[model samples]
Target: MNLSTSNQPQDSSIHILHDKESSHQELGSPSEDTDQQYHHDWKYALKHYFPHYTYQPIGTVQIEERPSWFYCVAYGIQHVLAMFSGVIVLPLILGYDSNTSLFFSGVSTLIFFIVTGGRVPSYLGCSGSFVSIILTISNYTSTSNSEMNTNTAAVQGAILVLSLAYAVVALVVIVFGCKWLEFFMPPIVTGSIITSIGLHLSFLSYDEATKSSFDTYMAIATASAIMLISVYAPTNALRRIALLLGTMTGYFIHAMCNLKGVGPSIDYSEIASNPWIRAPSVYFNLKFDSSSIGMVMPILIVLLAENLGHMKAIGSITHRPMLRYVGRAYLGDAMGCFVASLTGAVPFTTYAENIGVLSVTQVFSPLVILFAAVFAMLLGFFAKFSAIVKSIPQGVLGGVTIILYTLIAITGIRIWVVNKVDFNDTRNIFVGGLPVILATVMQTPLQVNNFQLDGIGAATFGSIILYQVLQGYDGLAMYRKSIKSAFNKNKPRETV
Candidate 1:
């Protein structure tokens, strides 16, 4: 059954009719007994709400069936580790509690599943797309290990407003369709936005790594470990955990250095002080400022593009017609971001890292992802776990961030490469180049009036306008045709 279709069976009794043959049997009769009909309807609702585990015996692991409990748990943890490096870094960089971020990540994933009818195999995580905007609006300049941005509440309020904008975009995509969005944000524009996000944070990575000479060495060592493991691991499973393993190895080295009194020692005080079980503190109460809204709302475009691209990629991979679910995917993501923003957590989005894990492990079951979400929520409730995560050295994180951030930029370039973007045309070149340049320059923290417009904000909105204006001129298409004709001019004529 193509669940993506609007014509999916709506009859309550359809749940019991497992296959087409069975469905035919039930279609001809309506139960005259009210109690019997009500009972069947209740069962139907339960089946749709929470499906049972059924083995397919002969197909790729997919949404419809659940794997064994043991396999589910194992793959679930793998998914968590795949996304851990990306998810934890956001809160650490932005100075929010990592535990709360984990909690919301899990909650958001489940929400995504519910909205998409448990069809999409995506895991929601902290989005790098929002980093530059948050930093700009909060006016955060401190790179130290201490407390960050005193005005985080204001940033939270801006995020809350931004969530509404996401919903509006989702609604538009649902009602009018994604074609309208594609008119403005093509591969060139979207790719540039992705590239700009990584470039904008390059400075932060360097700053974190170079805090001290010893730290710089540790950072290099940590990055080396990740590289070796990711590239040379004997098994796919080990490769999946490369980031975690590398970080742990770096921690061991740091511990030894501390024992020799040559490097900063691990501070166990936070772990010792924190209770085993405690709720995440409520820090992001909304305080809507109009200026903050302008600074942050532009990010909605970037997030929309990111989510849409991911959905398309997953669709292509699973060979499922996912276009119909695009609207629900956007709405689900927007809802997750809205919930996360309320609690001072970073906004959520479909994670490409987890998708990579799915690709590698060949495990596409949604049930495994659900297990991972539960594990993430459990981590959030444990204060000790949060403290332990906090104990990870900044130099170590910087090493991983250096790799991850660089990959993000490279991923953007790959988008163009994969799409066969015609850079021969000057229009494509200008569309791609200008946004990246503007975004990179704006990384220095530019502002107008009370609004702090970061590189990402400029690049995203700027690309949209540039593409539209260039499209109006229609010069690029003509130039591209001319280039093609010139190349063919020297070729020998073929006999017809």
Candidate 2:
């Protein structure tokens, strides 16, 4: 049925048919006709982007289709739960207020949506990649409280610079497009850096988890629960919340052990005493340290890779050419990072966990994600929620993070696989493997004069430089071959 030219009343709302083919074609990443229809009117685009309407339960809800309010709220909460385990860890470990992090996550997500014109459905979460760097730069583990406060300010400033770098790149992509990014940061380099980050953090998480016998057990239990639920759950929705449920299970077991005097006692005082609803203090002391900025700069590659990879992934799922909107996606991420850095929150990224949820449910409506953002903001206002989050046992956190980091490492490998990165080519092998080795082994920061570079930064620069050097050699070899060919051709006729 050609609904396009129907004589029926033209409803002012954006109408999507229940037909899968029609929905798939019309709904994702505004087509040329849709663009012409809006005539580049952002106000009109914004209104149509988030129209208040309900649709029948089609088999799959594409990015443009808004589901009923009930499904929107339910799925939104599920998204929040899915990402919370991985998202909240960075803040809690870094001593940032978890509530504030939660709030900014939502705010950043909203900003991302507005910047992207609500076309890219993504959830902003605390970037795990920055955790190790921030800790290293701040000397967080060893600093005294007063010194730590100063260090924290320095760290915030570094993040601010990082976001600016990110924004600058986004502007470049917006101006010149994203194709050149492949020349500089191909899958091999991107994948290796990601693997290095995961490996570096895996060691840290493992150490934190195994600090004591009880902690070891808690880590085991937590990881085991998440794995079990994720793999064996009877329903998809149940599997989606595996992280949250696994953490709860670990917490329960830890509490039980504490009651039996087998582990440290549970702390309930803070939860009971904290106010129900209170504003979280905003942290904003930007002290830009040159050394810190140098340390933080390398993460820009990872953020770029993540943002691009996410758009491609979503594009593939929704069957839309999402890379066309890559610039806007990058801009959205940069703005989100800016919001996070300015507000003393960690850098934000497009969450793979929430992406996993979208892939499973086959629902990509931006409005549902909007609901999730609102819910996350609401979570930040309840002081008790933050208290309860804080109350979770350290061992449980250890277990959860270990799994999360390992998955991150595996994701890098996945990138290599998806991109068909060949190890048989000797150049590819060195390009991909050596930098990861450097990052994994170089645990401590390497200092030159007053500047310091961590393992990840070293690996990032190492891979890029190595790749360029190899390309230069290739160019030289070609030139030499061409010269020899020319010489032989000139002499061949006389010799014959």
Candidate 3:
């Protein structure tokens, strides 16, 4: 009777199982088949965009390798162009002087590339999640300035110190025994975060979608056209740099318009004077004050938690065998913050824009990134190149950014697709989004002393707690009432 009906196939299955130990039984169902296919799609996308990380045997035979000189000069400049727009935006939004912000952004990017597994095929740029946090700090600092000589350095010190603390906690959690954390970070949550990032960026993208005069939407159209080509078209390695190519295309479109108005103004005297081989004068004699350091703990914790999940999501994208990328990324992130604080640089993190680039281009070599990073640092010091980069019409940058953000949104969708989740469950819908929505819409509605959480986080946890408690009572009460009703209905013997 114990004998099962299952029969092992003899030799009919010719498909070789390359995974060896791993089988369809690993997850207890054939459904993982879909998951595996989705994973394949994702890996293909990651390799295409980040060719520096993933090896393409076919590519070796098709294209000839150039001497290191031409590689460093030509391809390096392209790499710089790819990540340059991303590197400078952090300071712009953080309320720093243009020169200082630009310097720190550029320097921080260089440090990231040089340090964080230069073979990871990614760049460091401003993280959008940090935008809200930066703005929050600015508001607090500005509001508190009149009451006291509010120290920006001290605030940054707190962020750096607290951020490191958070990273350590995450690092420990990942290393020790939090593999269970994987369950909650399913595609739904990942997609929401990615969507949130793109949703936010749309405000800026719309600005770039039109011409400088605001009379024509040609630039935006050109940017969009290029994005479609990059995302959908079949082309070789050179054509894969769509965003870079798109921006150039938009510039030509703008130039044809021949408007007299300039976009953002440029300055190059310092870039001209900056030496190429000199030690970077970073980590300025900056010191943080002790006051208000405690206030930043929540943000740090939030980012730490968010980043943990983000690593898994990125892991799903790259076919890199381990979470080494995440570990190296955090190490770089913490180091970047430390350097940023010391050098008067803006607080920075891994840029999601570059992540989206991976989704678009199947290339993933670390060497290509190493080339890109060094060139960026050189460009940071080179004033002349900086001027031309800066002179790129705002509309052009905006148009490309619109596309940059779109890829980000798509990456989120891809994550969701790969994760087989039960969206049919109403509880899931409520659990995943309700809290964030509530937190964002209603800030500090309920205050128990100074412990006031915003709408989403509060509403989220509150509703669940409330529902669980109420559901328990309601179940017990209904059970008791039902028992009484049953007794009354079955009392036929006594009544007779």
Candidate 4:
């Protein structure tokens, strides 16, 4: 069920499936028949937003099956918990409204499900892919609240443009097919870009952790806890929430330090003053700065690679033909970003953490994701919840994020490993290794008078250009070899 193999033609390395015609051939029930038979009216119309799944054995749930209401809620909570730690980090780091981010994440998830016909089960949360570029655009030298807010507004405007660009890319995929993408951004290039991004962000995390000695220790404890629980925890449930649990452990330790008068105190005033339920502070003001747009545009590549990788992974696990709907999935993801952009939130991407939950639970039901979205929205409305999220110590977040960032880098390396990218090939060595070096060293923004590009952007465009250049060189070399051989064969009796 590897989407790459399932959809590809025998002769070509990449060939996209005709989603409209071929997608439903392998489906269990006719899409129209199932829709008409089960959902006759308005009440079940809501259910139509969900995908159709047939019954599996008692323990396992497939994409189209409906679980009990209780189980749905239970699994829904599991998904939210798995995604929460990662989702909140982006807004918190960027000084955006956390409540707004939480609310729209749910909204975006609903939009994604509808646009994809509920086939691809995913959660749209604030993306870290934009972090470096946004930071480069914002260029924050002062940490004042007013300045941060100003920079955040400027970043949001750039994000609006980025979102529109993403939607355009999706539209192209829908119309022209995704074959060009495969050739343009082969696994090596995509994987290298991903790795570079991870390395770039890891430095940020490390810097944040080292702000204070106590912070550094807290970070170590948090990362260690996450690694240990994820690797050695006996139960799947514990392993799934390792990030959350590890952060909590670090938070508790920091609180104890405060009691001992050794570390910075946790600010609880916001939590105490906030009402239990309140509307999120959401606003829209898009500013289109050319420099900012240019800085952030490269993130589009990462988003594309991430979405494709996520769908392929899900397809492999579920043993389903997931890529047939990939165009729709991309559209849905773009819509999610479009919605978030209007709300002054960062763009969203498919999360691998939630995919891990699916792999372990073996539940592919989109209904569960729907419930999780509702839960996230409810949490968004609870002002106290946002306050609590905001109150998490910087050190604790530092520790947690360092691990998360490293994981991001590892994901890119995993892509190389899983796809078996050959480093022995000089072309791959240049395409993959060079971008990573640029990403690692160019941690700060590179400035050339009026032009500015961050490490992530540099790595992204650099890899693509290098890949094309190397490909051309290889092609030319092959052509020269053929010419040389033909000339030798056609020479007139030279040896006689």
Q: What is the total number of backbone clashes in candidate 3?
A: 29
- Model 1 poorest ten-residue lDDT run: 487-496
Clashing pairs for model 2 are: none
Per-residue lDDT of model 4, residues 391-456, tens digit only? 888778888888888888998999899899999999899899988999888876877665678888
Backbone clashes per model, in order? 0, 0, 29, 5
> Tens-digit lDDT track for model 2 on 1-496?
2323555323232232213235546667455566554443444534555433347487888765777889999989888888875557667776667788888888888888777656678998877678888888767751101121235778888877777778888776665556667666778888887888888777777776877898899899999999999999999989988888898999999988877889877778888999999886677778888998888888888788777777777877877556656777777778877876677777787888888899998888888888999998999898988778777777888888888888888888888999899898898899889988998888889999868888888888898888878868674565565455434522211000
| CA RMSD, predictions in order | 8.9, 10.3, 14.7, 9.7
Per the 3 Å backbone cut-off, how many clashing residue pairs does candidate 1 have?
0
Clashing pairs in 1: none
Candidate 4's TM-score reads 0.84
lDDT of each: 0.75, 0.76, 0.48, 0.75
List candidate 4 stretches off by more than 4 Å. Answer: 1-50, 55-57, 140-150, 448-450, 473-496
Runs in model 3 deviating more than 4 A are 1-79, 89-121, 139-155, 174-186, 204-240, 255-318, 324-328, 353-363, 388-400, 435-496
TM-score of each: 0.85, 0.84, 0.60, 0.84
